[model samples]
Target: LWRVCFRRKLRPRQVTGDTTYGTVENIVAVEDAGIQAFFPLPDFDRRTPFFGKGTFTYDPGADAYRCPQGQLLPRRKTKYTEEEVLYQADSTTCNTCPVKAECTKSDHGRMVHRSFYADYLDKVQGYHETEAYQKAMRKRKVWVEPLFAEAKEWHGLRRLRLRGLLNANIQGLLIAAGQNLKRLLAAGRRHAPCGSLLALLREPWRLSAVYG
Candidate 1:
């Protein structure tokens, strides 16, 4: 989609999606293309009882995280498999701290993993607090989701019959075309005048003749 947009010289202001499309890679790619990505960040930390990752403040200049208790967690190691750098608090400091119980139960103290693309993720996350983001999300819910729902439920897109990537793309395009044609016909009917309806009913052969 971004390639097509670039080729056509279409400069979109923003892109919107659900959490499924909110990966760090996607956020970075869209933002690097100079478009705002309005999507919810997938926060798995929210399910934890301890202080969530959001509680930590990132200091880009220091390349460290400031904990809720004001302790700086310095970069410990990079987990290349996860594409993140781990920042960890000193275990001795955490063990003696007043907020240890609230922070973590791990013997190794509190740790926060910052994605290599965290800067972009931070920008995208900040967009969640904006009016434009809210408006875009609302529009996506009403304008975009229903088309996907219709395609999956009514257009046999729940599972693809084709075996290859190219075939699947073709099937999806055909389904979308069919969906668009349905909407176009419905719109035409709604806009047709009573006289036109009567004429079509009286001379059904005219419809066949015109279409043919």
Candidate 2:
């Protein structure tokens, strides 16, 4: 949808979502599609570490990460199954470090994993810590949640009655139309001649025809 919008010159300024859509993959995807996305960091990524990955800094020159213990964790191997590169500390260095026990249980010292696109993922995490990202996330929670609640509770859109893509889309549009008509009527009632508003509310079916 975003791509289609972009091609049609209807580019969206930004997209915001909650934690569920905050995966590294999704954030990278959103950014790749040329939209700024605001999402909280995923729980797995946000876990407090024994010695956090931040303790290991990357060196582009050597293409390796330097551990807190001053040991260089060079690229050990790449996993074919997962698009990740693993870097490991020398066993001798880890075995000799006074804080080895605090750092890693591995015989080969400590290992850190980096995604092929870890740079993009890290960029997303960086943006997540910004004040603007936080404000956008709060707005997302405030605006999107109520519509889902309203659809489920009042419009019976909690379960689908229709099958197939076409029918399901039609049902969704109809549900949205119903919700919009309700909002319009409520607004009208607030300002319309008093008795007429009551009459309109008493006969909401008339709204279906007008909305359609």
Candidate 3:
């Protein structure tokens, strides 16, 4: 979609989606395309009882994370498959620290992960504070989510009746077309303006891809 928009000189200023599309790779790809990524990161530490990942501050000059206890967690290893670098505090230091109980239960030490694309993720995280991000998310909730809900509830989209990618794609396309036609007729009944409706016609693929 970004490429299509770029080629047509209709590049979107921001791309919004739910957390399912918030992987590090996707966030980097969207931002690298020069569009803002308005999505929440999958915060694995959100429910952690101990100090969360956010409690550790990164020091770029030293290439390490400073723990709340003022200990520097130096880079330990890089897991390429996971696309993240591990930083860990010294086990002996952690075991002896006064706040060790609040930090981690690991005998090895407190650990923090820095993604290969941490910079991009960090930038996207900052977008949470922007009004533009809030507006985009609001639009997504209103304009995008209901289409899926309606499909699942009324259009037999709860489960696939067909098998295989080709057949599934065909089924999805048909369902989206039916939904579009229904909306088109409803718009016609209300005598809606043509401008946005025509834009919708031009981007039918978006409906198929999104709902599918």
Candidate 4:
């Protein structure tokens, strides 16, 4: 969506979404295209330390991570995809540490997998900590989430009526049309219901036909 909008020169001020779209790839794509993305970071893995990644600091000069117990986790090797580098602590050193039991359950010691886009992700994490991001999140909650709620709860859009992908897309657009008509009616009731209803019925395609 952002890419299409960008190509059309309809540059948005910012992009916002829930956790599912708040990924490192999406954030980097938006930021690279010169747009600010407002989103919260996903929850950390439960298997990780309760202190989370905050307890593991990255050292760029050494290309290593400093564990909470002060052990260095050096870069071991790259994954098959080459998009991620695995950093591992020495098993001997980790096993001897007094806090070993609390630190890692793996006998090979704790490992941190760093992505090629880790730096971009770190910057986005900083954005997530800001008040502006929180405010945008609130706005998203009000504007975005309610549309789905109304579609599902009132418009019988809880389940897809069609099977194939193209058919499903058609169904989705129909539901969106219904929602737009509902909003138009609600607004029309205030001043010009008869004219608005006639205009809507007469030119429904006017609302959906434009490509750019």
lDDT of 4 by residue, 1-212 (tens): 65468687677867888778888788888889787877677667555664466679999999999998888999999996868989999999988888877777878878888888888778877888788888888866776678778878987779888799877778778888888777677657865766876666676543332222
lDDT of 3 by residue, 1-212 (tens): 65567666786888888899987778888898898888898876778989999988999999999998799999999999998999999999999999988889998999998889989988999999999999888878777788889888999888999899878878778888888888766655666576656766776644534322
TM-score of 1: 0.82
Best by TM-score: 3
- Tens digits of per-residue lDDT, candidate 2, 1-212, equal 46557566777766777778877778777888888877666544247545777678998799899988778999999997798899998889888999887777778678898888888767777887788888887766666667767787988779989889777778778887887678667767777565656666686544432211
Candidate 2 vs candidate 3, lDDT winner: 3
Q: How far in Å is the alpha carbon of 193 misplaced in model 1?
A: 5.4
**Cα-based lDDT for every prediction:** 0.81, 0.75, 0.84, 0.77
Quick one: ranking by TM-score, best first? Answer: 3, 1, 4, 2
Lowest summed lDDT across 10 adjacent residues in model 4 is found at 203-212
Query: Tens digit of lDDT per residue, candidate 1, span 1-212?
Result: 56667677778999888999887778888888888988898777779899999889999899999999899999999999999999999999999999889889988879999888877887787888999999998878777778788888998989999899888878888887787656556545876654545554564322211100
Which scores better on TM-score, 1 or 2? 1
TM-score (all chains, Cα) for each model: 0.82, 0.74, 0.83, 0.80
Q: Which ten residues in a row have the lowest lDDT in candidate 3?
A: 203-212
Instruction: Candidate 4: list runs displaced more than 4 Å.
Output: 2-8, 45-51, 163-165, 190-212
The predicted structure with the larger lDDT, 1 or 2, is 1
Per lDDT, the best of the predicted structures is 3
Compute the lDDT of residue 157 as modeled in candidate 2.
Answer: 74
lDDT against true structure, model 2: 0.75
